[model samples]
Target chain A: MKSTLKKAGYSRVQKQMHDVFLQFTSKVVFFIIIMFAFNLFFAGHYTPGGGFVGGLLAASALILLLIAYDRKTLFKMIPIDYRLIITTGLFLSLAVPTLSFLFGTPFLTHQHTYLQLPVLGEIPLHSALLFDLGVFLTVAGTTLLMIALIEGEES
Target chain B: MTTDILVLLPIIIPMFAGLIMLFIGRRPMAHRVGAALTGLLMLIITLWVIIRVYNSGTMVTFIGDWAAPFGISVVIDMAAALLLLSTTIVTFAIVVYSFQSIGMEREKFYYYPLILFMLTGINGAFSTGDIFNMFVFFEVFLIASYVLITLGGTKIQLQEGFKYIVVNIVASNFFVLGIAYLYSVTGTLNFADIYLKLDNYDGNIIIMTIVAVVFLFVFATKAGVVPFYFWLPGSYYAPPMPVIALFGALLTKVGVYAIARTYSLFFIGNSAFTHQMLLFLAILTIIVGAIGALAYTDMKKVIIYNILIAVGIILTGFSIMDQTATVGAMYYLIHDIIIKAALFLLVGFIIYRTGKVDSERLGGLIGQHPLAGWAFFIAALSLAGVPPLSGFYGKLFIVQSAFENNHYIAAIILLLSSLVVLYSLIKIFINVFWGEDMDFSKLKPVKYDKLLVSSIGLVIVSVAFGLGADLLYPLFEMAAEAFHDPASYASYLTEVE
Candidate 1:
């Protein structure tokens, strides 16, 4: 059957199936771990955990996927370039505060505004969140990129 | 709006450019676009910073709406702004210069983002009001630099880069430990807040002294002072000329700026201990750096050693603790960045032409490459403190200020070091440019690339600074004013809040 699969162009599909199964299972387990880490990060912000830890957790999720699957498969799964993630993260981090300069305020001046949604309720969008999201993306992207480079070199 | 933007713009503009570059940097067209946009944006922002700093006392920005004591802020006084302006200028020059010197393969990958990130770290370090934030930014910059330094993955680069990374990591760990102790003592990361809190606390002088000494060691490693400077010559000479030029120009200066800021604001109260230590370090650094310069035969090594000399001079300014001495330090810092960058770029050009940086194999290119030779001569003279040039003014100011402050020993060491620097630079000039004409039959005539020419243009601007000192002196004076007046920075942030 393996020989048949290899000869019939099913090898690619077979390998991909094996890869996908491994990735999906690991991702599930990894997602749970990350969710746990995220909760801990949120609770520990005033104590220890913050953007850096949260970002590291997200990166670890990607690392888990990389471990379970091939680079090409993993690259396909994560469509956005790690560089873009890093850059966008940095931009978001820098931009939120820069907006304050426009309003004659100092940089990174966190202004909170509650947006009235049509049905859900009021959503509080604080600039600090944007900065945190930026930090998250940068850390995750940078970590993933480093992992990718090391993996690429090793292969 | 003008003043606030002026303060924020230098940092914001480069950051934005950096972000934009990250997306489009893979495309050939994007490289040009990124370079042009970054250069233009930097130039405009620097000009705005200069104008605003001259007109309005100092600019301050608070991050996240938190007041000065509670949250992070970025303050851009004349000194910070001037450093920002120079950083932008050197980055712009190097980026333009990279167009030709860096291969297309490299430009597509690391060149633009690394530079932009480097600038971000530099600008962040310069503008940040929080000491911890300064450390964070320093890490940001250093991490990028580690990548940039090791970008090509050559054996020599890998070896030297490893040492550089290890040394910097150790320094960083020390920096973090210092911050921890500082926070434990003062319970604040804000520079001004720490200053205000520490002013009243009569803590154990011994603990404070140890922390201060540790802080000095961390910065000294970064700034390439004396015993901590071995990594600089080897690592700096490992990378391509353009990378080395940028590193030579800005990295140590950022370290020096941190020292200057910390010493002036937080540590000023303990001047008797801190200043004396700095005075001793400065003199030792000068003597050691000059001797190193005399010993090294490689052009890059000599330049790196000269950077140590510049560090010594700048430290001497910091050590004296007088207003005039600080001003001299400020001027010297600015002059050193411009001249040293120019010198490194000139060396890059020579290497590009000669296919070698060693003086042993290279000879008699003065006539063949007159432009490169003369540029090297001017930059070397400026570095050695030749009269009527930028270097001379900086050395003269420091010497005068040191003498006025009764630091005659430091003054004399500075002067004697300048003479030693002169000898080493002249040694390069004689051997590389002026000695007997070597075999040219096999040698390819060095074609001056446009990027190389643009770098020379930057050197020309530094030379112009020398020629037009009268015009630039007022700006330096304003910068001196800004550094001395911590109240202005603190009050500005508080008022905004």
Candidate 2:
């Protein structure tokens, strides 16, 4: 397939152009900033920045790296399995409500507190925020994994 | 004694499950574990909601200590709860069916989470007190569905899925706009609040009708009503069977549920105008759907078209707006969810076994797989509204309701459409299962594990509703009452806190 693409006059410069255009600018900083904006705007929703936006940001970052470097380099840098990211997100989201069940609160009844983290100072950890973060990670990881599979088809 | 968690459980469980599925979806074992656990949890939650509503009355929950107009709320009256229960059952069956059909290669980590999110949307639509929340939930489910529909990322899947995504996104934007206009006019998003406000605003009836019509078009697209239904067949035909079955069973019904909920609660006075429009659309939908079904040779495509038929009948029943008709529509909606899912799964099984879905190329499966053939037969019979099955009761109720309302022409069309549906289904049965034995020497006998499980589950469910009509009749009646009486729902929320 690589040889066929090469034979078809696919140049490294074109690839580099794509890496610069589609991957670097769109995926890394812009994607993250867009996600932050989405969350900040929709925070009135009681849940900050939804999972969908978060997922897009994370996935774009990975896709950018994949385009800038080779797949092998991309793979090595992200040594953690994509599945683990998704699973951990799922677990954290489920854990909050499941723990609420133990306390006799209805499922997803939000609980919150402020915790002091030496250098980070007091940070509020609302269960809803945790839920949102879970959504973000899962969306990001799963979407990246899907894009990876699609990109892999080229090889 | 305590506030009812039953109403809230369906929404919360699936949201939690989606979150968990996101994390655990990468491993097949973990995915299965997560799927099974969530399925069981949903089933239990549904059954518990049923029992609670049966014992104490409707379930209502408020969010963030806010009253109905001030904050988000969830309400599960009998109708909503019944739909929620059916959705849970269908989703559980589909999830179980997916275990075998969606092999590890395609059961990507995101699949389970997407399904859960899809369920969250369905449940949220069923239980949400606010219209805006319903729109939000609809978007949630819609986005998840777009992802699920295109899970495999085939060129065709992507092509068709893009159309599906674009159409739904447009509809959702329209839905948001409709809700904004509704909120501006009524000063509230809660269903009960809207209903109450609507009663006082007799002067702006024209504007109200226009908004209602806008909502009708938005939901019509979602429900696959005629003219707006073109996207359904092509897009649905692109997905894998399990996913298609899930979509066939649940997605359009959510749209129908929204239409039913909104019209009943807020637009009761405008039924005469709305019902006439619905009647026209419903008739067109039935004819179009039946014709589309006949046009398709592939079993999955035929089933997709038949789903549109079911949507039409349910809408037709709703259009009549009589109590009995509403009851019939509710019954049909539930029955269709079970039978259609079963039919889709069966077709999936056949495709798996034969590696061909075109009816013209397939034959003689009855002798080879008696279990599957028989299950398909029963499901088809139920779908055709044959006597002694659940399907008959729904049609019977709708027809009787039509006659009661003196809608002779509408009643005739309903019966005629059923006959067309029957013929289409029979064509499939004869072509795929009974005619000539196709060569199977080269093909290994495919295991119909998920098909068998879900088929049996659906068959038993349909039978229970059929044989125990008396027992289920009151449930349908209760659903009708819940829909008709907005006060009961409104009072419950206000009374709760």
Candidate 3:
């Protein structure tokens, strides 16, 4: 497979130029996506959108990167394992409910409190938001994993 | 509240363990140990919950802080507890059996995690008190099973798995539609709430009956009963042994459990009409399953038919809709889960050692693999409803229920089908175990001790369940009573905290 690919491969200069342009566009898209993802993630606690949507948006950004560049290039750019992200997210999400058990609440029973921070003003903290972050990471990780796998398979 | 918290353990333990196993990556030994430990913990937790539920009656826990009717609730009744226990038992056995049975490559591909996730779904489905929550859990298990089925990415697995997914997706749509219709009409999704609303609704019963039929079709498809059962044998035939064992043991039973739960709780409004339809479906399921079993020469396909027979039997008990009949059904359901797992695992062993699934290429395995042969013999007998085995009691109770209700045709059919079940199983036995002793050298040599022990563990459980039925009868009685009276369960929603 590699020999055939090498034999067919040509015009490295054009490919590099295209990748440079693609990289430029993907970065812009990535920034906008991150902005929207975090916006949705934070706004979710107060409104309609939350971790799932943000996570999905974030995943879409990753998918866009895959489409713009090859999986190998994208992996080199991100340098992060999606599977590990998924496991971390799962543990985080699981920990949210588990924390409640420590406080004699049922699984997934969340509470909100106000905490004064020196750098930031009084912050309203809901344990569920943490759980939502876990959900975000999980959804994002799994979605990216699927895309990465299929991309890897095709390449 | 604590009891409610306890009900969440089965779901959480497996979910957590499965998640943990995901990170264990590529280490087959670690995955096996992690999965086995998880399975054992789940079994212990399930048994504890069962004992607690048996002592205290049904325990209901709402998810988060939301109350029943508004949020998802998990209810651990005698029936649910029994199902949970059976699931954990089979899970533990299969987890152990997978060490020798499942390929190492499959192990590295998150096999253990998928099984645990599936168990989480099964446990949640059984214990959830809400209808929609049941749907969510059903999806959980279905997706997990789908992944497990296609793990090898074999051509057959992929082809059959696609069909399985399509069928389930359609059935799930019907399930959701049914739930939507019921919710729109009754304005509730809680099982108990629906029971109350259904009882109070004085409007036209026709729409409700239609909803019941839709729900029945959905569950019947899941359970692999007649007319809707065409997908089972082919799909189940594709997966590896331990997976097929898990599917044979727990998956279809989850569907049966859903049917029994909904029918007992909400379908009683038009019992005369709805139940007559159910009885006809049940009898048809039996006849079709038996015919399919008799027609199949392949070991896996034949076992798949036995699974259908179990489904038909459980549905028959539900269709009879009497205390005795429900008890019989519950007994059979439990018996079948263990026995079927044993049978599937044994067949998987036979296939692995002999490299043949068809009895035509195999003969006289009892001469060499005495333990497996005997174990298969015992499981086959139990499955066939032979006397003093657990299967016998379930058949007996159903038969007695039929006689009591003067459904002589049903009784006769039940008896004749049991004989057919015996004949079909015996044919496999005679062909594979008794005739034309083959040289042991020609067969692939592998470690059979662990797999044999796991198979025997369940076979012994079946025998003990049978002999100890006198002691276990009260539990079944309580389960039956709980099935008969939804009011007792419904009252929980009205109890002011």
Candidate 4:
């Protein structure tokens, strides 16, 4: 979360206007990206949008933040390590397949179940969703890490 | 279901272990112990699979309970099982060796995990019955190997890694392109299905030849055959000993195995042309490989070129395309896996002791490292096809089959290359292990009993393969049978139908 980036030579653009219009646009983009990613992930199993697209959306949000407020401010707001996120994603993806082994099923065989809830009627849960979430996290983490490494190297 | 589980276990075990290793805490000791245990478990599973497949005939397992041609399937024929077993053995030895030899920093950066991942890809490649799945598995191992080759991040390794990556990327493009051409004609990606459908598509001879040649180029690049082998020597010479040992033992063989599988199963439409091409390229491979070995003074380069020589021998046997030649190729394949790995490790040990890998700078290591020197001598002889060694029997069967088939020129090249192989290796042996001792003031002392033990274990297996050929011939026969008849192999899928 520390601001190791200095306001000097390697910044791609020095045109930070510090205007309210820019601030409002950034906030709107951030919120839209979050909701879009959520919708893409949860609806991935039965719908067109999936973990891969959702994770890419999440990465784009981070890039937007990087541009709006600079990396130092971005890091302060989101204090998560991309590498750790990558590891978690990797574990989640592997765990789903390994879990099938316990049930004496083939690796990566998905089992689905529906639960009748009070508010959300007949919500279907799938093991594949867990795999999708893993893909999402991994893609997001990897893309962000690559950006960070390239950015840091330049500066 | 039980058989399905067994087929799935070999590929899944290492994959799950590899992924788990990535998330584990930053303790190198735990990762090492975990990787070693994973390797041992794989060894046992592969051995069990080999035996089970031998007894039961070819067994096909459809993943996710879907039948063949519609879903991915794992086919465990005797040949595939044997390959899986040999690859697993070499991987286990390399894993154990890496524990002490690879530095802690590299291990911490997902080295063990990458090894397990590499094994997963290799096993998957060998077992999968689908051609596209083969490409998928190839990519898995390709990515892992790219990381492994450049893990140390030295100047030379980086240079070599770039070239290696570029070559593989280009080859992979051809792989996908060739697959597209194949699927367009046959309308299926499954190996058995494609073979069954080959009869229906009789008019596209030119397109089929193009597709087959493209695939042959792809595999030839991978196997480091003559025209495409320039990238292999520098890339292999760049990696560390354990990594190079793994590369020498398993990587190129995967390519050769793929060629054997596809050419036998599906590309029989133009065998006269295709097999002739294989023979011509194989002859070029042998000559270039022998000359490369003779040309190199660096110990590692010599070993690398020797690898190319083994490739030529195996391809020659494969191109002859008979049961005897197939068995000989299998024998030579397994033997080369063991002895080549042993040679690399032994040479690495010598380099560790002498602080240099070039032959001219090293001399009289017999006094200081007699065990390694003798191990090297035996392995070299084995590589050169001396009698009573594993390499000789492989050469014998190959030559016999060639003469029987009236391939006198191939038989001559096979025999002549054996002598050239002998000369090149003996030149290295005398130059490095005999004569006056080199100065040792700059040598760094590291304990090597553990490293030597693993290398010795490999040497023992290589020797056992020679001395126990009587006991192992039946197994080789079973493997050869799998390749000798494509009908029986294709029937594994047709059984349910």
Candidate 5:
């Protein structure tokens, strides 16, 4: 799939776009964003941070990498098709409600309980965590897929 | 217990099936087979529910075991079951028709999943008892439609799709505003609870009237009523035949359904004012649609305009707010969903075979595709309310109620629009099918068996639906009963607690 931008001969006339310092910092920024995104995701059930926000945060980190690197390197590093990611996220989300069907509960019924973890003592566990994970994956996958398509067109 | 809970299946099945289809990578044949099976499964489930609702009366299920009034309620009364049944049938037909007509490349681009999601939304819209939840389902389908309309990526499609989205998004904002107003006034999103609350409220009734009219504006835009219908004809014309059939048969009807649901259930307090206003707009809608249907020589626009006309007639019945008229609206709504789907599929097949949209360019298709020609004839008559066909009983009851209600002008226009419908379709039949077999560049032997089977299948169903109106009368009556006597519906909700 040849891009229109490439076809327009702008690639030859344009200046070399990458800056050395910016590239190194982007990698650092990507890791930090991913870590913070997970924190927000885990805290989402009680706090304001949930799947939708966390997914966007994580997707933005990957988008930074795409901006700094080429499509070839990006795909080589993470080879999963973006569409698959979206499907997986949706399945996970739907699975939670579907499980409720098996449990003889109503649709979208989520059960929560307290769990004793070896390292974490008493912790809250929720079926909605899986549902939120689905939302997170879907948001991240959809954002990145859209950006990837637009990036292909432009660069 | 599980059997009662099957109320959620109509919405759930489609989403689950579509996602699973997406999961299994793209194989065009697999997608077609999978989607066809899913549609069939949904059709069977809907039929069973419709029958059970007919025998047992209205059924309600609350999500997450949340009690009524506080949690989301999924209701399957006679009206909703009827809508679901027809929607599923049409969906099945469209899926089968797309097998032959929609190109493999496009099918590979997740067409089946889009169809499934749209089904999910349509089913959700029909079954939901919560007003806010209805808006959510509307978005689910509208988003799917945004992609379906522009699937081929034609310039016309993109342009039309953009306008279609803009119109709907703005309308949806109004939908939310209407909900907000209703919520503020009633302190409830549940339809049953709102019904109970609005009845007891002593506040200024004027605000409720404004909220009703605001909803009227929102739904009329979606249903393609006059003044707001400018975008409908163009948008409907841009999509491929199957997509067009889906929009023509289902989407606008969702709007019509919203109007009927809201008006009959919650907004009847000031009947004289709100219903009269509804009647006025419905008349104008029918007039504009009748004129537009005749104005177009292009087969697609004619059928598209006919969609608006059907919406008008159904709404007119709803606006009358009488037992007979409400039953007429429900019956007509079901009939229109089926017949319009059949008409669009038939029209689509012609365009596919002849490769021409204009009736002037096409000639003597009956000589080559006699089966399609005959099916279109039956569908046209059915659409025009010729006796014993699908459209007749609905229109007959509507006209009868219009007279009973002393809505003399509405009754007359309702009768006149039937003539326009007949003439417009016969014009297509005579011009396109009855001409001298004119040669065309794309007159190759196209494989049309799958398309024909599916489209003709709907034609068969329409005929059956018409002939079986006697047996179906009880179902239609029960559907109408809920509107007139809300005691059963209200009591059911009260009993839930």
Candidate 6:
């Protein structure tokens, strides 16, 4: 046992340690969750799903990536500042609502219509959808940013 | 509809400015210019809007074509406009002051954006015609303030900011709880609609009073009314000068505004009990706050405690709920916001100059910086409601109304509260500015020109507001009318569906 330990210790091992399963599962799950978030966001226009929940779901997917990898790698992959995301989200939410003011409508007047596309079937389109997108970005951004701040504080 | 859109501008403009600054990113000069311009624009817009409202009636907008009783509504009644006017003036001055005082580090680290965002919340809270919307705006500002209090990330700040956050979170929960209970009882959240629904509410009166009391408790905590004031001094002490000035100037007043609003609007169902309860609390708050001011030799604590005293006096007038008294309260409210912000800036400057907060360590600034010394003295006198300055007329009207209502004790206490205010403030003057001049050669130099300029501007407003009370009286009278007759403010709402 002592000879075997000395043999292992004396050897210069250059192989990198890796969480192969975690990396693979996280990559697969990230896309799946993102797809689900988009679906939820779109479905919010007519059904029970909406931007807030969709945003949270999307954030969780990113959080999963963060857990599997690390903050440095996750941020490198996304290359987006979360504070910018938050402010942009806020701007989007604010701008979308006030779009009515230009058209001589009271603030936040939403409009919707049914439309036919070249390949897709009939679908509903709404200003509220844009609003929901804003909400989605805001919730997602706020959650991730707060987590990042807390993490930075601890370190 | 044009005027209707103006109701949303106060909230929208500051928010848009804040976002634009965020997008601009890290340009200190640009941030300062943007902040100053936004502050100026707010002043202009509020002035214009107030003029329009004065000429016409209240401006009400139903967001997204939502009617007054159902969807989100924005109303710029006489009272809201007046409050907004005062708010803009204070914010503008603070913005200007922040240029020199709020250190470069905090400035680059999103200070202007946070201040503007806080402005957006304040304007929203004042103009929102929905109770639920008011709570949302409260959260909006409170969140900004949380970041602001911890802006520099100092140890004392973190400790105090934590307590501030905890206290506010609990108050917000109570606020939501109160709103929920009120909604459950009234079947509505719009202020006027709730009034309409509760006019003949066959529901239990006990539940209604309980809910009203709950709201009172919540706002009292926000406004730092006596028993609930434990967190105020410590939390306020934690931040930098400009941030503290912002808070002292505006935050507590929002709470005062909320209390005035609820009591005047939906809670009048049992004013005899509810208002009497308010009167008792206001008196108790005054007594406790005056005692606090006396006990503290620390400059900041003395000024912070003065805020509580001002709140008590304002609410004392409001509790009477008469035409004269509401006018008095509104006058005093505006006056207090201005003077308190000025006093805070002045005191903050003193602390910055001396690197000392205890009055015992500060002395005879009058010999060196006579302008600051005299500014503090005048502001101190004005704060005590000395006649020929801004604070006197409000106190006079309050005492007159109290005597008219035969609440003789309240009147007497209010009268004596002024004396206490005078004594406490004068004590600071004597201790800090009256004795031998502190050794200036040993003290580090500070850039006092701009700081003095900004704070003195507010002091001038207080002086003008007092001297030119006649010119402003019509606006205050209109506000008082709005207070007495809710229907005049309500009749503008166009029903939908």
Q: List candidate 3 segments past 4 Å from native.
A: A1-23, A117-120, B2-4
- Candidate 5: the clashing residue pairs are A44-A49
Task: List candidate 5 stretches off by more than 4 Å.
Answer: A1-16, B1-3, B440-442
**Per-residue lDDT of candidate 5, residues B271-364 (tens digit):** 8999998888899999999999999899999999898899999999999888999899988999999999999999888888878889988888
Give lDDT tens digits, candidate 1, residues B230-300: 78888888888889888988999999998888877677667798889888988888888888899988888
| Per-residue lDDT over B1-497 for candidate 6, one digit per residue giving the tens place of the 0 to 100 score | 63267889999999999999999898888999999999999999999889988998778888878666788889888889988999999988888888878889999998998999999999999999899999999999999999999998899999999999999999999999999999889878998787767766777888989999999989999899978989999999999988898998899999999998888778878888999999999999899889989999998998898898999999999899898899999999999999999999999888878889999887888887789889999999999989899999899899999999999999999999999889988998888888987888866587778889999999999999999987889999998876777666566653322
- Model 6 CAPRI rating: medium
Report the first chain's TM-score for all candidates.
Answer: 0.69, 0.65, 0.80, 0.85, 0.86, 0.83
The C-alpha RMSD in Å for every predicted model, in order, reads 5.8, 5.1, 3.7, 3.8, 3.1, 5.4
Give DockQ per model, in order.
Answer: 0.41, 0.24, 0.50, 0.40, 0.50, 0.50
Residue pairs in candidate 3 whose N, alpha carbon or C atoms collide under 3 angstroms = none
The Cα error of candidate 6 at residue B338, in Å, is: 0.3
Instruction: Quote each prediction's TM-score.
Output: 0.90, 0.85, 0.95, 0.94, 0.95, 0.95
True contacts kept of 2: 0.24
DockQ of 1: 0.41
**Cα error, candidate 2, residue A46 (Å):** 13
Interface RMSD of 1: 2.9
| Minimal lDDT window, size 10, model 4 chain B | B1-10
lDDT of 3 by residue, A48-89 (tens): 789999999999998888778777788788887777899989
Interface RMSD of candidate 3, in Å, is 2.0
The residue pairs found clashing in candidate 1 are A97-A108, A108-B64, A109-B64, A109-B65, A110-B64
> Is 1 or 4 the stronger prediction by TM-score?
4
Superpose all Cα atoms of candidate 6 onto the true structure and report the RMSD in Å to 1 decimal: 5.4
**Candidates sorted by lDDT, descending order?**
5, 6, 3, 4, 1, 2
